[model samples]
Target chain A: MNGLKNDGISEIIDGKRVIVKKPELLAPAGTLEKLKIAVRYGADAVYIGGQEYGLRSNAGNFTFEEMKEGVAFAKEYGAKVYVTTNIFAHNENIDGLEDYLRGVGEAGVTGIIVADPLIIETCRRVAPNVEVHLSTQQSLSNWRAVKYWKDEGLDRVVLARETTGEEMRLMKEKVDIEIETFIHGAMCIAYSGRCVLSNHMTARDSNRGGCCQSCRWDYNLVEMEDGAEVAITQEGDSPFAMSPKDLRLLQSIPGLIELGIDSLKIEGRMKSIHYVATVVGVYRKVIDAYCADPENFTIQDEWLEELEKCANRPAAPAFFAGTPGADEQLFGVHGKKASHDFTGLVVDYDKATQMVTLQQRNFFRPGDTVEFFGPNLDTFNQIIGTVVDEDGNELDAARHPLQIVRFKVERPVSKDDMMRKGL
Target chain B: MNKPELLVTPGSVNEIKKQIEAGADAFLIGEQRYGLRLAGEFNRQQVKEAVALAHEHGKKIYVAVNAIFHNEIANELDDYVAFVKGAGADAIVFGDPAVVMAVRETAPGFPLHWSPETIATNYYTANYWGKRGAVRAVLARELSMDAVIETKEQADVQIEVQVHGMTCMFQSKRPLLGHYFEYMGKSMEIQKRQGTQNMLLHDAERSNKYPIYEDANGTHIMSPNDMCIIDELQDLVEAGIDSFKIDGVLQTEEYRIETTKLYRKAIDLCVDQPDQYEEEKEGMLEAAEALQQEHRPLDSGFFFKETVY
Candidate 1:
C-alpha cells in the first residue's frame, strides 16, 4: 500500500515545485484507503472519524484497528492523523466517551478534533499525549476566542468559515496558537454546529450523528393571510433554496500562506478517493508553488482544470474574500455532477515492461484515453490499447468495481497515481 | 438554591416592566445588530432605560452582545460591550469570544455568560468558561434531562436553561429571504419582515409552516412547534438549575406575559410546595397550551429521549 517515501522539499517534480514551507494541507480521510491516497497525494495531515461520536455517523468511519493502520500509514509519510470526536455530547451519548477517547488515543492518532469542552478536557485527562484541536463547530471568529481556548490548553483552533480576512489577520496578530482555516470544499450555509434543520424537520438529531442535509432540500416560502396561505415563491421557476456553493479558494493560496495561516483544510470526509487525491494533489501543488517563490507565483490553468474534474457541484471562493452575494448561493435544487468519471488508480507499476497494474473504479474500455495525475510527477494522457486480467487473459473493458487489470500505458507511475476519463 | 431565577427575553423595552410584573426575575435585552436570535433589540436609550427599570424593580438584566462578529461589527464591539456594562447590566451574555475580551478590556468585573448558542453540552465545557471568568453558561437546547441535571450538579458556574419559547432551527449570514425576493421580480425590506404576522417557510416534504425572517445577522428559520416545557420545570428546578429562560421573541405581549407568569408560578410551586404543583401540573400545561398560536405546534423539546433521535 506504500511506495516512494514522502521526503518533501527534496526536488522539484517536473519543475512544478520544491516544497518550501510547512503550512499544513489537511484532507479528509473517510476510509483507510482514502487516508493512504490523501498522504500519497501530498496531504500534510488527514482527519478521520471513528464509527461513533463523529458528526458523520454514517461516514463509514475507521474502526480502531483501521485507525491504527491509517495512523501508521500516515506516519510512514511523516504526516499526522487527527480523529474527530466532534459531536455535542448529549447525556445518552456521553457515557462511553472517555473510553472512546482512550481507544482513539491508543490507536496512535496525533490529535483529536473536538468542539465541546467536555471532550477536550476528557481527552486531555484520559490521554494527555493526544493533542486537542478545537473543531470549527465552536464558531471561533476572532482572536479572543482563540486566546480563550489557547489559555485553556488547546493546541489549535479551526476558525469558523464566517471569519473574514480581517478577522484571520487579527487572530494571527493576537493569538499564539496554531490556526486552521477551511480553504475549500462544501460550505455550510448556516454557522456550523448551530443548525438543527434535520432535528426539526426529520426528528434526527444533527448534534449526534444524524444530519439529513435538509439545508440542500427545496422549500416553499409562504405568508399567512386571513387563514389562507399565500405563496411567495412559486415552483418550476424557483425553489426556496438555501444551499451555498462548494468552497474553492484556489486563488487565495498565496494570501493564506502569506497571512501565516497554519493549516488549510478541505471539507468532505465522505467524498471519493478520486476527490481526495485530486484536491489534495492540487492544493499541495498550489501551496508548494507559492511557497517556492512567494512573489512570482500565479495559479496555473491546469491546476484549475484538475480541480474542475473532481468538483461535485458549482463552487465559489466562499467567505474567504467576504460574505458572498446572490452568486454564492445555489438557487435551484440540482447539484452539478463532476465533468469526468474516475476510472482507475495505480496499484503497482512495472517500469521494465512499461505496464501498470490497475484497480478499476469506473468502467473503462481498452481504447479509451485516460489522463493520469500524481503528486510526484506531471500529468500525462495515454491511450489504453489493451487490458489483461490478473491471469493474463484479454478483456474488452475494465468494468467491475475494484477489478484488477494490467495495461501497457508506457508511462511512469506511482502506487497511488490516479486516472480519470480524458477530456 | 434560590429556586432558580426566571429569565425572559423581552421583545421591547415596554415589555420588561410587564415581564417583571408577570413574575420574570430577569430579562435579556440587547441591540439586535449585536445579538443573535433576540426577541426585541433595543437602541442605546432603550437599553439604558430597561436596565434602570429592571434595577428599580430589584431584578437583573443581562445584555446580549452575542452576534457572530464580522470585522465591521467588531469595530464597535468594545464600545458596545462597555456601553452595556456602563449601563450597569447585571451581566453580558455573549456568543462570540470577542465579547469576552471586550468585557475584560473595557468592562472589568462584569459577570459574563458564555452563550455560544450550542456546543455547551457537558459540564467540563461549562466549567472551562467558568474558569475563564464566565459566571454562567447557557446550556444548548439539545441537552437531555439527565445531561442537564449532571451539568447542574457538577459545574460551579450558574447554569441557565430555556424553559419556554420557539427554538430556532437554522440561521445564516446570507440574506436568503432577500435573495429569494430578488430571485423573483419583487423587493422587500428583509429586516422588516420579522413579526409581519405572515411570513413562513414550508419544507417541500413537510406539511407544517415555519416562521422565517431576516435581520442583520441573517436569515432565521424557527421550529414548527413552539417548545413549552412548563410541565417539566419541576424536574429542572429540583435539579438545582440556576436560571430558567422563557424566549419571548416572536411571541405576542399577551403570550409572553401569560407564559412568564405560568413558568413563575410553576417554579415557585416546584420549590416551595412540590405536592401542590404536582396536583396543578395538568392545569398549568393547559394554560401554556392555550397561550400558543393555533398554527404552531407545542411539545416538550428534547425533554424526552424517544423522540430526541
Candidate 2:
C-alpha cells in the first residue's frame, strides 16, 4: 500500500497500490506570503487572482510577474495554482482578450477560470490549448447548462454554491466533467455571481468586481407622505434581511467525496496567512484520516474547534442542506472580531535545554495563557513562564514584531504548534 | 382623418370597455393597484381573453412579460411561453434571451417584440434579434432621435419608440433601492397614494427621491413625463418609424383618450398637408405642454436627431 491509500479505490502508480485522495485541500492565496504559508501547511492547491480581472477586487492580488513567481513557487512545492479572470467584458475591452489569454498561457498557469461566454469563446479561439474552467458566476443550475459548457470544451465547472450534494451527484451523473464547489467562504445574497443590485443601486457592478455591497447596509422603512420612519432593521438584528452566514462543510467531507467532487474550494482570497494555513492544515488532516479509514474514521471535536478560530458567522451547511431563507443573515455586527490574536508558529525547537524558541507575532508576558494550535491538535492552552529574548536578556514581554523569543516549557512542543494569545 | 392609436391601461373589463368607448385604439391590461389588480394578470389565458375583448372593439392588445427570471423559474416560464403561443398574443414583449428563445421555439409563428429592458442601443443588436425572430425592438431611452432613425435604417425589425410615459432612470436589471426599502419597513405604496405634488424626501444624501406609499395606496412617484409627439409627426414619418408606443399601461382613461386623439389628428394632417406639417409643429408642442402641466414633465425622446432643448 502506498502513501495515497485511504479509500476503497486504489491505483497502482509505479507498482504500488496508491489510495486515491478524494477531495483536494484547495486554499486561497491573496499574496505570495499566503501562498507559501498555504503550501507549507499542506494545501494540495491554491486559487488566486491577477491584478485586474478577478471577482474579488478588494483582495491584494498579484501582478503578472508576481503571478509567474507565485506559480513557480507552488509548482516547486508540488502544488497546483488556478488563476481567476472572471469578469464580464464590455465590447470596448474585448480588443485585449487574445493578449490576456496568450499572456496567461505563456505564464504556464494550470487553467483560466472564466465567467462570460464571450471570454470562453475568445479563449477557445486565442489559446485553444489552455484549460478553461467555467466560473460559478454563470449560475449553472441545470444539467442543460452544464452540458452546454461541457460540449463547448470546458474542462471543469465550478458548480453553483446554491446546489446540494444530492443535486451535485445528479449533475455528476448527467455529465462526465470535473466539478468544483465552494466548501467554505462568504456567501452572496444574490444568486451566485449574477447580482446587478450593487451596480443598479450604487453604480458599482459586482459582476465587474467593483461591488459597494449596498445590500449589507442597515435600512429603515418610512412612510411616503409624512416620511415617517416605521421600522429599522440594523445589521445583524434583522432576520429577514441580514448577510448570509459563512459556509462550513468540514464535517461533511465523506459525503462530499462520495458525491464525486473533483475539488474542495476554500473561499477567502483576502484572508491572512494564518487563516490559510489553519484551514488548509485542518482539512488536510481530516481528508487524510478519512482516506485512511473511511468506515471507522470520525471527525474529532478539535477539528471543528480549529475551524471556528479562523473567523466564522454561525456556520451553516448552506444550500447543500436546503435553500436558505431570508433570515440566514450571514453578515454579522460591525465590531465583532475573533477574541484571540494569532502571533506565530514555532518554527524550530531546541533539544538541549528542553526550551522552545518562538517566532513571535505579538507581545506575550509570563502567566498569559495562550492556545497552541497545530495541524493535528485541535487547540490546547499553555501558560507562559520564564521568557527571554534571543539575546538571552530576560524580558517581561516580547513587543517587537516578528521578534524571536525563547521560553522554557514543561511539555514537549513540535514545529507545527501555533501560539496565540488572549483566546 | 385617421386617428393615432390610443393605448389605455385598464385594470378591469369595465375600465377596458370605458377606454374603448373613450377612443382607446389598444388596451394594455396590467396589475397595478387600481388598474389590473391580479398578479400574473397577463398570463396565456388572460392574454387570449383580453385580446378577444380588444378585437371585439376593433382594437389591439399587447401583453407585458418583462420581469427578470432566475434559473429555477426557467421551466415554469416554458409553460407560460407555450401558453402565450396558443393564446395568439399580438406580440410577446420580453427582456431575457432565454425567455425570447423559449417563446420563439414554443410559438414560432407568434410575433416577438424586444422590451426596452434589453437595451437595444445600435443597429447591430437590433438586427441581431431581428434575424432571430424578433418582429419589433423597443429603443433604449438614452438613444437620440437621429440615432433611432439610423438604427431604423439598419434594422430589419419594426421600430417602437416610447411617445410618452414615466422613463426608468436606471437600467432595467440593476438593483433598486426599493428592494432595500421594501426589505425595511418603508412602504412604497404610500407615495403612490399621496400623488406626485406631495413631496417625499428619501434621505438627505440620496440624489433622487421617488414617492412611496403605505400598502398599495401610495402613489408611485417614478412616473415619467408624458410624451406628446403631434408636432413631430412629419419628421417621425420621414424617419421611417413603423410604430409609436405610448408608455402608460396604468394611467387615467381621460388622459389616454385625450393624448391618443390629439396624436391621431396630427398623424392625419401630416399626410394631407406635407408642406404645412412643419408649420403645425408649434401647435403640437403646445398640446404636449398642456398635457404635461396636467400630468408630469415630458422629454422629446430619441425622435429628434439631437437632444431637444
Please provide TM-scores, in order, for all candidate models, with all chains considered together. Answer: 0.92, 0.68
List all candidate RMSDs to the true structure. Answer: 4.7, 8.4
lDDT of 1 at A330: 82
Task: State in Å the error of residue A251, model 1.
Answer: 1.0
Q: For residues A154-189, write the lDDT of model 1, one tens digit per residue.
A: 999998888876668777777788899998898789
Position B134, candidate 2: lDDT:
79
What's model 2's lDDT at B43? 38
DockQ of 1: 0.60
lDDT of 1 by residue, B140-259 (tens): 877678778988998889999887888788888778888776666466645456446468888656788888887778888887887888777777887889999888777778889889
Supply DockQ values for each candidate. 0.60, 0.11
Model 2 chain B worst lDDT window (10 residues): B212-221
Q: Return the DockQ of model 2.
A: 0.11
For model 1, the stretches where C-alpha displacement exceeds 4 angstroms are A1-22, A226-228, B185-197, B272-275, B307-309
Interface RMSD (C-alpha) of each candidate? 2.2, 7.9
Question: What is residue B69's positional error in candidate 2, in angstroms?
Answer: 6.9
